[model samples]
Target: MNIDKITRTNPENMPAPVGQYTHITRIPRNAELFVTSGQIGADHNGLFPESLNEQVTNTFNNIKTVLESERLDAEHIIKVNVWATEKIDWDFLYAEWGQLFSTDYPAMTIGYITALGLPEIKIEIELWAAKV
Candidate 1:
């Protein structure tokens, strides 16, 4: 199956979405659409870790878990958005990102902010993936 018409644009250029979502995605009507809830730095046991690196790692792992549940993988992802409580350590996040995604990196957005739901939690990631 082919994913149709995936598009991303600067918010300044388009009408903003009605909710927390940032963009309007247009795709083939027949293609299945997958939406994932915000994945935080929580483990399978629903525990949030204290370290930033550990939190980021768990966030990505949680994303992977959701993708796997839909019979998808990182390669199938088309877009990604990340929210972090602290200023992101670019080097660290990039290194961790390399472990999950090879050269086929998806469209990504990352925001560094003051806080998250829990003070100890460091990151939240959500993404869109489509089948090839």
Candidate 2:
């Protein structure tokens, strides 16, 4: 018997995801689960950058660090959630993000709003990854 994958998705007739993620995800009953805390734009020394692009880069780097600990790479990510204090520069974000993944891009959702935990921080990104 083949086990079905659990995925969360809106109606195909509905509009596509606005940002980086689908409202749904698919998982196997026996799949290994990995949960990452919301990653902020802080460095090892707790340094927060002022520039939006810098913060986005650092945020991705922070996620990479977490993924590396599990012997996983960016391509392994299946779902992602991003939060930003202001509107993101998708072009800038893509420029930096494109350097990490080759072809397989993960499902993602990016939310832009007013504030984050730290005032200096402009963005926070979290992700879920699994081997397909």
Candidate 3:
């Protein structure tokens, strides 16, 4: 895929995105879309970290692993949905996010929730991707 086949736009009619993401991602026709189960703060070894920062980091690492397993990278990402049990460390998360997406940001939605699938899981991220 050339990557240009995916289009992202932040409409002038609406306020700018609150974070480092676009409002819309238009996928080309005939593109293949992939969806993943919510990725939690668990490592490949099934170890869950104790701290929020470590959990968040592990979550991102898990996301990357899932993407790679599907033969996709951040470029193939169309949307990212994040759910957190507590306030996120934006500086830390943005750093990880930047490393993953670089400048090719995709549409995203984030929410602060009360709990997740597990007690130790501080955050979960679900990804939507496409390839043309």
Candidate 4:
């Protein structure tokens, strides 16, 4: 299996996702899988931004850096899981999602929690990708 063989779908009977993501993703067996640890809005120096929007942005940037380190891009991503300590800015998140994925959305879930790893960390993201 390869990146081109990955399947993304939204069944007609099911309600659409509230954000920029597909309802399901199917990755073929035998594909190489890459999974990342949950990433927070911190830089290499362990500094985090105060704003939720900036935190979310930094979180995604960190995810990107991890993926690139493994020679993978957004297109190889099959699933994403996000955790946030505050209410999400759907518009801002969707805009950033578009920048990274365009129309090739992946299976995703976002959850609001009371707290994260640290008090200053507003958002965290983890993802799975595949390649042949």
lDDT of each: 0.72, 0.76, 0.90, 0.88
lDDT for model 4 comes to 0.88
lDDT of 2 by residue, 22-63 (tens): 555667667677778888888788998788888888888888
Best by TM-score: 3
RMSD of 1: 6.0
The residue-by-residue lDDT of candidate 4 on 1-132, one tens digit each, is 454478899999999887789998988887899999998999778899899998878888888899989999888899999999999898998877877897989999889999987899999999999985
Residue 100 lDDT, candidate 1, scale 0-100: 78
lDDT of 3 by residue, 1-132 (tens): 444499998899999888999998999878999999999888889999887789888888889889999899989999999999989889999998988987878999999999999888889999999988
Candidate 3 has which clashing residue pairs, if any?
Answer: none
Candidate 4 versus truth, CA RMSD in Å, comes to 2.1
Candidates ranked by TM-score: 3, 4, 2, 1
Best by lDDT: 3
Candidates by lDDT, descending order? 3, 4, 2, 1
What TM-score against the true fold does each predicted structure earn?
0.73, 0.79, 0.94, 0.92
For model 1 the local lDDT of residue 60 reads 81
Compute the lDDT for candidate 3.
Answer: 0.90
